[model samples]
Target: MTRELTPKGSATRQRIIEGAAAEIREHGVAATTLDDVRTRTGTSKSQLFHYFPGGREELLLAVARYEAGRVLSDQQPQLSRLTSWRAWEEWRDVLIQRYRRQAWDCPLDAVVSQLGRSTPGAQAVLTELLNRWQGEIAAGVRAMQEQGEIDPGLDAGQAAAALLAGIQGGVVIMLSTGRLTHLEAALDVAIQHLRESRDRHPADH
Candidate 1:
Protein backbone atom coordinates (compact mmCIF):
# COMPACT_ATOMS: atom_id res chain seq x y z
CA MET A 1 0.00 0.00 0.00
CA THR A 2 3.03 2.22 0.48
CA ARG A 3 4.97 1.75 -2.71
CA GLU A 4 7.44 4.42 -3.76
CA LEU A 5 6.33 5.75 -7.15
CA THR A 6 8.91 7.36 -9.39
CA PRO A 7 8.18 11.02 -10.04
CA LYS A 8 7.15 10.27 -13.61
CA GLY A 9 4.92 7.41 -12.54
CA SER A 10 3.37 9.60 -9.86
CA ALA A 11 2.71 12.35 -12.34
CA THR A 12 1.24 9.96 -14.88
CA ARG A 13 -1.04 8.39 -12.30
CA GLN A 14 -2.18 11.80 -11.14
CA ARG A 15 -2.96 12.78 -14.69
CA ILE A 16 -5.03 9.66 -15.12
CA ILE A 17 -6.92 10.27 -11.91
CA GLU A 18 -7.62 13.88 -12.76
CA GLY A 19 -8.72 12.90 -16.22
CA ALA A 20 -11.02 10.24 -14.88
CA ALA A 21 -12.45 12.66 -12.32
CA ALA A 22 -13.18 15.18 -15.06
CA GLU A 23 -14.92 12.58 -17.18
CA ILE A 24 -17.01 11.35 -14.29
CA ARG A 25 -17.91 14.83 -13.20
CA GLU A 26 -19.06 15.69 -16.70
CA HIS A 27 -20.74 12.42 -17.71
CA GLY A 28 -21.47 10.66 -14.43
CA VAL A 29 -19.58 7.50 -13.46
CA ALA A 30 -21.81 4.96 -15.18
CA ALA A 31 -21.54 6.82 -18.48
CA THR A 32 -17.76 7.32 -18.45
CA THR A 33 -15.42 4.73 -19.91
CA LEU A 34 -11.79 3.64 -19.77
CA ASP A 35 -11.37 4.89 -23.31
CA ASP A 36 -12.62 8.30 -22.20
CA VAL A 37 -10.03 8.41 -19.45
CA ARG A 38 -7.37 7.06 -21.81
CA THR A 39 -7.99 9.82 -24.34
CA ARG A 40 -8.26 12.45 -21.65
CA THR A 41 -4.91 11.50 -20.13
CA GLY A 42 -3.26 10.73 -23.47
CA THR A 43 -2.35 7.38 -22.01
CA SER A 44 -2.10 4.18 -24.00
CA LYS A 45 -3.92 1.10 -22.78
CA SER A 46 -0.64 -0.48 -21.67
CA GLN A 47 0.42 2.60 -19.72
CA LEU A 48 -2.93 2.77 -17.98
CA PHE A 49 -2.87 -0.89 -16.95
CA HIS A 50 0.73 -0.59 -15.82
CA TYR A 51 -0.36 1.91 -13.19
CA PHE A 52 -3.62 0.21 -12.29
CA PRO A 53 -3.36 -3.55 -12.57
CA GLY A 54 -7.00 -4.16 -11.68
CA GLY A 55 -8.29 -2.24 -14.71
CA ARG A 56 -11.26 0.15 -14.84
CA GLU A 57 -12.62 -0.64 -11.39
CA GLU A 58 -9.17 -0.13 -9.91
CA LEU A 59 -8.80 3.15 -11.70
CA LEU A 60 -12.26 4.23 -10.53
CA LEU A 61 -11.27 3.52 -6.94
CA ALA A 62 -8.06 5.47 -7.45
CA VAL A 63 -9.99 8.42 -8.81
CA ALA A 64 -12.35 8.19 -5.88
CA ARG A 65 -9.43 8.37 -3.50
CA TYR A 66 -7.98 11.31 -5.38
CA GLU A 67 -11.25 13.23 -5.20
CA ALA A 68 -11.54 12.46 -1.53
CA GLY A 69 -8.07 13.83 -0.84
CA ARG A 70 -8.91 16.91 -2.84
CA VAL A 71 -11.84 17.63 -0.54
CA LEU A 72 -9.24 18.47 2.13
CA SER A 73 -6.26 19.56 0.01
CA ASP A 74 -8.25 22.47 -1.39
CA GLN A 75 -8.39 23.93 2.13
CA GLN A 76 -4.69 23.96 2.85
CA PRO A 77 -2.51 26.40 4.88
CA GLN A 78 -5.70 28.00 6.17
CA LEU A 79 -6.78 24.59 7.43
CA SER A 80 -3.28 23.58 8.51
CA ARG A 81 -2.13 26.96 9.83
CA LEU A 82 -5.08 27.75 12.09
CA THR A 83 -3.00 29.37 14.85
CA SER A 84 -5.15 32.47 15.33
CA TRP A 85 -8.65 33.94 14.90
CA ARG A 86 -7.49 35.51 11.66
CA ALA A 87 -6.56 32.12 10.23
CA TRP A 88 -9.94 30.60 11.13
CA GLU A 89 -11.70 33.60 9.62
CA GLU A 90 -9.74 33.12 6.42
CA TRP A 91 -10.49 29.41 6.43
CA ARG A 92 -14.19 30.14 6.88
CA ASP A 93 -14.17 32.32 3.79
CA VAL A 94 -12.30 29.68 1.82
CA LEU A 95 -14.79 27.01 2.87
CA ILE A 96 -17.73 29.15 1.84
CA GLN A 97 -16.21 30.03 -1.52
CA ARG A 98 -15.26 26.43 -2.22
CA TYR A 99 -18.75 24.98 -1.80
CA ARG A 100 -20.48 28.02 -3.24
CA ARG A 101 -18.72 27.49 -6.56
CA GLN A 102 -19.06 23.71 -6.56
CA ALA A 103 -22.70 23.65 -5.52
CA TRP A 104 -23.68 22.53 -8.96
CA ASP A 105 -21.08 19.82 -9.57
CA CYS A 106 -21.37 17.78 -6.39
CA PRO A 107 -18.69 15.64 -7.99
CA LEU A 108 -17.76 13.74 -4.89
CA ASP A 109 -21.33 12.61 -4.26
CA ALA A 110 -21.94 11.85 -7.94
CA VAL A 111 -18.88 9.65 -8.33
CA VAL A 112 -18.69 8.02 -4.92
CA SER A 113 -22.35 7.04 -5.04
CA GLN A 114 -21.81 5.40 -8.43
CA LEU A 115 -18.85 3.49 -7.02
CA GLY A 116 -21.20 1.77 -4.54
CA ARG A 117 -21.08 2.76 -0.87
CA SER A 118 -21.22 -0.93 0.18
CA THR A 119 -17.81 -1.77 -1.30
CA PRO A 120 -15.19 -2.32 1.39
CA GLY A 121 -12.58 -0.36 -0.51
CA ALA A 122 -14.96 2.53 -0.99
CA GLN A 123 -15.82 2.59 2.69
CA ALA A 124 -12.17 2.39 3.66
CA VAL A 125 -11.30 5.28 1.37
CA LEU A 126 -14.03 7.40 2.96
CA THR A 127 -13.06 6.42 6.51
CA GLU A 128 -9.42 7.25 5.85
CA LEU A 129 -10.33 10.58 4.31
CA LEU A 130 -12.49 11.55 7.29
CA ASN A 131 -9.79 10.50 9.75
CA ARG A 132 -7.13 12.57 7.99
CA TRP A 133 -9.53 15.53 7.80
CA GLN A 134 -10.37 15.29 11.47
CA GLY A 135 -6.68 14.98 12.27
CA GLU A 136 -6.07 18.28 10.48
CA ILE A 137 -8.89 19.94 12.39
CA ALA A 138 -7.51 18.53 15.63
CA ALA A 139 -4.08 19.83 14.71
CA GLY A 140 -5.57 23.29 14.30
CA VAL A 141 -7.31 22.91 17.62
CA ARG A 142 -4.04 22.01 19.34
CA ALA A 143 -2.29 24.95 17.71
CA MET A 144 -4.78 27.37 19.27
CA GLN A 145 -4.63 25.54 22.58
CA GLU A 146 -0.83 25.76 22.68
CA GLN A 147 -0.96 29.46 21.83
CA GLY A 148 -3.17 30.07 24.87
CA GLU A 149 -5.94 31.17 22.54
CA ILE A 150 -8.29 28.27 23.29
CA ASP A 151 -9.36 26.46 26.41
CA PRO A 152 -7.12 23.55 27.29
CA GLY A 153 -10.29 21.85 28.61
CA LEU A 154 -11.54 21.83 25.02
CA ASP A 155 -11.40 18.24 23.82
CA ALA A 156 -9.71 18.82 20.49
CA GLY A 157 -10.30 15.31 19.16
CA GLN A 158 -13.95 15.27 20.11
CA ALA A 159 -14.46 18.80 18.88
CA ALA A 160 -12.85 17.98 15.55
CA ALA A 161 -14.92 14.81 15.16
CA ALA A 162 -18.15 16.68 15.82
CA LEU A 163 -17.17 19.46 13.44
CA LEU A 164 -16.35 16.98 10.69
CA ALA A 165 -19.65 15.18 11.19
CA GLY A 166 -21.49 18.47 10.95
CA ILE A 167 -19.66 19.37 7.75
CA GLN A 168 -20.40 15.99 6.18
CA GLY A 169 -24.06 16.24 7.15
CA GLY A 170 -24.28 19.75 5.78
CA VAL A 171 -22.59 18.68 2.55
CA VAL A 172 -25.04 15.82 2.11
CA ILE A 173 -27.91 18.22 2.60
CA MET A 174 -26.37 20.67 0.15
CA LEU A 175 -26.05 17.98 -2.50
CA SER A 176 -29.65 16.94 -1.95
CA THR A 177 -31.04 20.50 -2.06
CA GLY A 178 -28.44 22.31 -4.19
CA ARG A 179 -28.27 25.01 -1.53
CA LEU A 180 -25.32 26.45 0.39
CA THR A 181 -27.32 27.61 3.37
CA HIS A 182 -26.88 24.43 5.40
CA LEU A 183 -23.16 24.26 4.66
CA GLU A 184 -22.72 27.91 5.61
CA ALA A 185 -24.77 27.47 8.75
CA ALA A 186 -22.79 24.41 9.84
CA LEU A 187 -19.45 26.20 9.56
CA ASP A 188 -20.64 29.45 11.06
CA VAL A 189 -22.28 27.81 14.05
CA ALA A 190 -19.34 25.46 14.61
CA ILE A 191 -16.80 28.28 14.62
CA GLN A 192 -19.02 30.43 16.81
CA HIS A 193 -19.31 27.54 19.27
CA LEU A 194 -15.53 27.25 19.35
CA ARG A 195 -15.15 31.00 19.83
CA GLU A 196 -17.71 30.85 22.61
CA SER A 197 -15.75 28.08 24.27
CA ARG A 198 -12.63 30.23 24.11
CA ASP A 199 -14.51 33.26 25.41
CA ARG A 200 -15.80 31.33 28.40
CA HIS A 201 -12.21 30.99 29.57
CA PRO A 202 -10.80 34.31 28.34
CA ALA A 203 -8.47 34.62 31.33
CA ASP A 204 -6.91 31.30 30.34
CA HIS A 205 -7.09 32.07 26.64
Candidate 2:
Protein backbone atom coordinates (compact mmCIF):
# COMPACT_ATOMS: atom_id res chain seq x y z
CA MET A 1 0.00 0.00 0.00
CA THR A 2 1.13 3.58 -0.63
CA ARG A 3 1.64 6.00 2.20
CA GLU A 4 -0.23 9.29 2.08
CA LEU A 5 1.85 12.42 1.75
CA THR A 6 1.51 15.49 3.94
CA PRO A 7 0.83 18.87 2.32
CA LYS A 8 4.51 19.80 2.18
CA GLY A 9 5.47 16.35 0.98
CA SER A 10 2.83 16.59 -1.74
CA ALA A 11 4.23 19.93 -2.83
CA THR A 12 7.76 18.57 -2.91
CA ARG A 13 6.62 15.58 -4.93
CA GLN A 14 4.84 17.86 -7.39
CA ARG A 15 7.94 20.02 -7.70
CA ILE A 16 9.96 16.95 -8.58
CA ILE A 17 7.38 15.87 -11.15
CA GLU A 18 7.28 19.31 -12.76
CA GLY A 19 11.06 19.44 -12.84
CA ALA A 20 11.22 16.02 -14.42
CA ALA A 21 8.65 17.07 -17.03
CA ALA A 22 10.70 20.13 -17.86
CA GLU A 23 13.82 18.02 -18.13
CA ILE A 24 12.06 15.61 -20.46
CA ARG A 25 10.70 18.47 -22.49
CA GLU A 26 14.16 20.03 -22.85
CA HIS A 27 16.29 16.94 -23.33
CA GLY A 28 13.80 14.29 -24.42
CA VAL A 29 12.74 11.44 -22.13
CA ALA A 30 15.51 9.02 -23.22
CA ALA A 31 18.23 11.46 -22.19
CA THR A 32 16.78 12.66 -18.88
CA THR A 33 18.22 11.04 -15.73
CA LEU A 34 17.15 10.93 -12.10
CA ASP A 35 20.14 13.09 -11.29
CA ASP A 36 18.98 15.64 -13.86
CA VAL A 37 15.61 15.75 -12.17
CA ARG A 38 17.19 16.01 -8.74
CA THR A 39 19.45 18.84 -9.84
CA ARG A 40 16.59 20.60 -11.54
CA THR A 41 14.26 20.25 -8.54
CA GLY A 42 16.97 20.67 -5.83
CA THR A 43 16.01 17.33 -4.34
CA SER A 44 18.34 14.80 -2.71
CA LYS A 45 18.40 11.18 -3.83
CA SER A 46 16.83 9.95 -0.56
CA GLN A 47 14.12 12.59 -0.83
CA LEU A 48 13.37 11.57 -4.40
CA PHE A 49 13.22 7.92 -3.38
CA HIS A 50 10.89 8.75 -0.49
CA TYR A 51 8.29 10.17 -2.85
CA PHE A 52 8.90 7.80 -5.77
CA PRO A 53 10.14 4.55 -4.33
CA GLY A 54 9.83 2.84 -7.69
CA GLY A 55 12.57 5.21 -8.88
CA ARG A 56 12.66 6.47 -12.44
CA GLU A 57 9.64 4.62 -13.77
CA GLU A 58 7.53 5.84 -10.86
CA LEU A 59 8.64 9.42 -11.30
CA LEU A 60 8.00 9.12 -15.01
CA LEU A 61 4.45 7.97 -14.30
CA ALA A 62 3.88 10.97 -12.05
CA VAL A 63 5.15 13.25 -14.80
CA ALA A 64 2.87 11.44 -17.23
CA ARG A 65 -0.08 12.21 -15.01
CA TYR A 66 0.99 15.84 -14.80
CA GLU A 67 1.29 16.12 -18.55
CA ALA A 68 -2.10 14.47 -18.95
CA GLY A 69 -3.68 17.05 -16.67
CA ARG A 70 -2.02 19.80 -18.73
CA VAL A 71 -3.61 18.40 -21.89
CA LEU A 72 -7.11 19.21 -20.59
CA SER A 73 -6.21 22.21 -18.49
CA ASP A 74 -4.66 23.92 -21.47
CA GLN A 75 -8.10 24.03 -23.10
CA GLN A 76 -9.39 26.12 -20.21
CA PRO A 77 -12.93 27.53 -19.61
CA GLN A 78 -13.91 27.08 -23.26
CA LEU A 79 -13.65 23.30 -23.03
CA SER A 80 -15.96 23.20 -20.02
CA ARG A 81 -18.56 25.61 -21.44
CA LEU A 82 -19.58 24.06 -24.73
CA THR A 83 -23.27 24.94 -24.33
CA SER A 84 -23.50 27.09 -27.45
CA TRP A 85 -22.18 27.13 -31.04
CA ARG A 86 -19.91 30.09 -30.27
CA ALA A 87 -18.50 28.33 -27.20
CA TRP A 88 -17.75 25.18 -29.23
CA GLU A 89 -16.00 27.25 -31.89
CA GLU A 90 -13.88 28.91 -29.25
CA TRP A 91 -12.99 25.56 -27.77
CA ARG A 92 -12.05 24.24 -31.20
CA ASP A 93 -9.83 27.26 -31.82
CA VAL A 94 -8.14 26.85 -28.47
CA LEU A 95 -7.39 23.19 -29.15
CA ILE A 96 -6.01 23.96 -32.59
CA GLN A 97 -3.88 26.82 -31.30
CA ARG A 98 -2.50 24.56 -28.54
CA TYR A 99 -1.35 21.93 -31.04
CA ARG A 100 -0.12 24.55 -33.44
CA ARG A 101 2.04 25.97 -30.70
CA GLN A 102 3.20 22.50 -29.69
CA ALA A 103 3.98 21.45 -33.25
CA TRP A 104 5.92 18.14 -33.07
CA ASP A 105 6.95 18.17 -29.46
CA CYS A 106 4.41 16.26 -27.37
CA PRO A 107 5.70 15.74 -23.85
CA LEU A 108 2.93 13.35 -22.80
CA ASP A 109 3.51 11.15 -25.83
CA ALA A 110 7.24 11.11 -25.18
CA VAL A 111 6.85 9.99 -21.56
CA VAL A 112 4.23 7.41 -22.47
CA SER A 113 6.45 6.04 -25.23
CA GLN A 114 9.41 5.80 -22.82
CA LEU A 115 7.24 4.06 -20.25
CA GLY A 116 6.01 1.59 -22.83
CA ARG A 117 2.48 2.25 -24.07
CA SER A 118 1.45 -1.33 -23.17
CA THR A 119 2.46 -0.92 -19.53
CA PRO A 120 -0.43 -0.82 -17.09
CA GLY A 121 0.59 2.51 -15.62
CA ALA A 122 0.82 4.28 -18.97
CA GLN A 123 -2.37 2.64 -20.23
CA ALA A 124 -4.29 3.70 -17.13
CA VAL A 125 -3.16 7.32 -17.52
CA LEU A 126 -4.16 7.38 -21.19
CA THR A 127 -7.50 5.63 -20.56
CA GLU A 128 -8.38 8.03 -17.79
CA LEU A 129 -7.48 11.06 -19.90
CA LEU A 130 -9.52 9.84 -22.88
CA ASN A 131 -12.51 8.93 -20.70
CA ARG A 132 -12.53 12.33 -19.03
CA TRP A 133 -12.15 14.13 -22.35
CA GLN A 134 -14.93 12.12 -23.96
CA GLY A 135 -17.19 12.65 -20.97
CA GLU A 136 -16.78 16.42 -21.27
CA ILE A 137 -17.57 16.30 -24.98
CA ALA A 138 -20.62 14.16 -24.31
CA ALA A 139 -21.79 16.61 -21.70
CA GLY A 140 -21.45 19.39 -24.26
CA VAL A 141 -23.52 17.40 -26.72
CA ARG A 142 -26.24 16.86 -24.13
CA ALA A 143 -26.19 20.55 -23.32
CA MET A 144 -26.82 21.38 -26.98
CA GLN A 145 -29.62 18.85 -27.03
CA GLU A 146 -31.25 20.52 -24.03
CA GLN A 147 -31.06 23.88 -25.84
CA GLY A 148 -32.74 22.38 -28.90
CA GLU A 149 -29.56 23.01 -30.90
CA ILE A 150 -28.88 19.31 -31.44
CA ASP A 151 -31.09 16.36 -32.32
CA PRO A 152 -32.79 15.04 -29.20
CA GLY A 153 -32.52 11.43 -30.40
CA LEU A 154 -28.81 11.54 -31.17
CA ASP A 155 -26.44 9.45 -29.04
CA ALA A 156 -24.27 11.97 -27.27
CA GLY A 157 -21.74 9.41 -26.01
CA GLN A 158 -21.24 7.86 -29.43
CA ALA A 159 -21.03 11.22 -31.11
CA ALA A 160 -18.45 12.38 -28.60
CA ALA A 161 -16.47 9.17 -29.06
CA ALA A 162 -16.33 9.60 -32.84
CA LEU A 163 -15.34 13.24 -32.55
CA LEU A 164 -12.64 12.39 -30.04
CA ALA A 165 -11.31 9.66 -32.32
CA GLY A 166 -11.12 12.08 -35.20
CA ILE A 167 -9.27 14.59 -33.07
CA GLN A 168 -6.80 11.94 -31.98
CA GLY A 169 -6.23 10.86 -35.55
CA GLY A 170 -5.64 14.44 -36.56
CA VAL A 171 -3.19 14.93 -33.70
CA VAL A 172 -1.21 11.87 -34.78
CA ILE A 173 -1.10 13.15 -38.32
CA MET A 174 -0.01 16.60 -37.17
CA LEU A 175 2.72 15.07 -35.04
CA SER A 176 3.98 13.21 -38.07
CA THR A 177 3.48 15.82 -40.77
CA GLY A 178 3.48 19.10 -38.85
CA ARG A 179 0.27 20.21 -40.49
CA LEU A 180 -2.88 21.43 -38.72
CA THR A 181 -5.23 21.01 -41.69
CA HIS A 182 -6.47 17.57 -40.69
CA LEU A 183 -7.18 18.60 -37.11
CA GLU A 184 -8.95 21.74 -38.26
CA ALA A 185 -11.01 19.74 -40.72
CA ALA A 186 -11.91 17.19 -38.07
CA LEU A 187 -13.13 19.86 -35.63
CA ASP A 188 -14.94 21.83 -38.30
CA VAL A 189 -16.63 18.76 -39.77
CA ALA A 190 -17.67 17.42 -36.37
CA ILE A 191 -19.16 20.74 -35.31
CA GLN A 192 -20.83 21.18 -38.65
CA HIS A 193 -22.40 17.75 -38.33
CA LEU A 194 -23.80 18.67 -34.93
CA ARG A 195 -25.29 21.86 -36.41
CA GLU A 196 -26.74 19.96 -39.35
CA SER A 197 -28.47 17.54 -36.99
CA ARG A 198 -30.59 20.49 -35.91
CA ASP A 199 -31.68 21.00 -39.50
CA ARG A 200 -32.49 17.31 -39.98
CA HIS A 201 -34.61 17.11 -36.82
CA PRO A 202 -36.17 20.58 -36.63
CA ALA A 203 -39.51 19.18 -35.50
CA ASP A 204 -37.96 17.35 -32.55
CA HIS A 205 -36.52 20.56 -31.15
Best by TM-score: 2
* Regions more than 4 Å wrong, model 2: 203-205
The deviation in Å at residue 82 for candidate 1 is 0.8
Write the residue-wise lDDT of candidate 2 on 66-150 in tens digits: 9999999998898889999999999999999999999998999999999999999999999999999999999999999999999
Each candidate structure's TM-score, on Cα atoms with residue i matched to residue i, is: 0.91, 0.98
Predicted candidate 1 versus true structure: per-residue lDDT over 1-205, tens digit per residue: 5668999999999899999998998888888999999998899999999898888888888988989888888898788888888898899889878888888676766667777987887898899999999998899888888877777789999999998988888778877898888778888888888878767886342
lDDT of each: 0.85, 0.95
Model 1 local distance difference test score: 0.85
Best by lDDT: 2
| Root-mean-square deviation per candidate | 1.9, 0.9
Give stretches of model 1 more than 4 Å off: 1-6, 203-205
Superposed by TM-score, candidate 2 places the C-alpha of residue 130 at a distance from the truth, in angstroms, of: 0.2
Weakest lDDT window of 10 consecutive positions for candidate 1: 196-205
